[model samples]
Target: MGEQHGCQTCHGDTDAHVADPTMKNVLVYQAKGGSAVDELSAKCLACHDSDTHMAMWKMSKHSRNDISCFNCHTMHATRGAVDQPTKCFTCHRDIKVAVNKQSHHPIIENKIKCSDCHNTHGTATQHMIKDDTVNQLCYQCHAEKRGPFVWEHSPVEENCLICHSPHGSRHAKLLVEKVPNVCQDCHDWSRHPGTPYDANAGFTGSSPSNRFFARSCLNCHGAIHGSANFENHGLRQ
Candidate 1:
């Protein structure tokens, strides 16, 4: 780890630069259309290839896209700059907006980081998520939703993305769609569920309040996720 294997290891043989003080003699990591991305990345992987977090770097989207470590990291910077999310937000502007939505994970608050759910170096899972499955990643924080209920909701069991948007959504509870509408996607729209409810239907209280007037389907079917009640198969409990 002396000068022979230190900065010169990546900077290339710099004896000529030290002797003559010429920029052309030293190897620069920047993308100047001179060196291929692989050539530049190889210098970084020389040391990082053995690190546990970097084991899957070759399979990562960044690597596939020709993004070198130098793109996001500055060798001269202090430790604080190396781990900050600000550099990430420069390229992931959309995620920055999504994280600021009314309902979102605590990324801005620093309680949760992008790395908490994602392996930037790469993973077998799509989106580079840390867990094998999306639901498994979510289960880390929402343990209550990881239940084996007596009567399980098909969407909840299959995938959380079926009803919720993982990033952010304007709808309440990060729902992909509004309450009754979201429920109606799979429910048979034959009777009460399909009926349109307007103020005119119950303005004078002559008719029972429509689904839209109250808390929608959830008013009665409180246990939408699942129901443990022995007699309440409809999730009324």
Candidate 2:
């Protein structure tokens, strides 16, 4: 309540509030506070300067879309951090459903937060990803996939999304689709028999083939991500 105190950090110019207890004289960030989005954000930006994680906030998707800081944060709220997946999922309903899928990144388990890979404050990337590229972000955890292999998978090097879904997947290992099928997306595999093709296929192979006999494509091609081994050009290492 004092000038030297930190109350003024957010409740800007509390003199009027002190004078009139009933007056909505102080700056409030909520809708009933009658403060504009820009005005409310300006108050936060005044302290959260654009130097740290808040850098490039003006270029952020949330900023461009008129999202306010209070939308995700309530510093004086009831209990512990309410801005976890609970707050994020409120707006991102689709991702909420995705995270509950068979294969996910342990978000529901509370092992990770959305901020682990995303910068809600601001970012230069499309999805507000913490890193410059999707592959770079995935490399944070899947470091083995980040290799300077002699036989580099073009899709793996280009984007991890091509074969995997970051949020979740019905397929194991967060794969976008079942094996051999995911491979057939580019390999154009029609030579061998017993192909239990994807949804579009008319003939679903009944007999077990080399591709689906054991662990599917992983049976022979384990290092499908990339291969440093000159011994196996097919990346079977």
Q: Local distance difference test, per candidate? A: 0.74, 0.79
Report the number of backbone clashes for model 2.
0
Model 2 lDDT on a 0 to 1 scale:
0.79
lDDT of 2 by residue, 96-187 (tens): 99999999999999999999999988887879899999999999999989988888878998999999999999999999988877887776
Q: Score candidate 1 by TM-score against the native.
A: 0.82
lDDT of candidate 1 vs native?
A: 0.74
lDDT of 1 by residue, 87-131 (tens): 778788898888788887777788878888888778877999999
TM-score of each: 0.82, 0.79
Check candidate 2 and list the clashing pairs. Answer: none
Candidate 2 global TM-score: 0.79
What candidate 1 gets wrong by more than 4 Å, as runs, is 1-5, 18-25, 188-209, 212-215, 230-236
- In lDDT terms, which candidate is top? 2
Which regions of candidate 2 are displaced past 4 Å?
1-9, 12-26, 189-215, 230-237
**Considering summed lDDT, which 10 consecutive residues are worst modelled in model 2?**
206-215
Per-residue error for 197 in candidate 2, Å, reads: 17
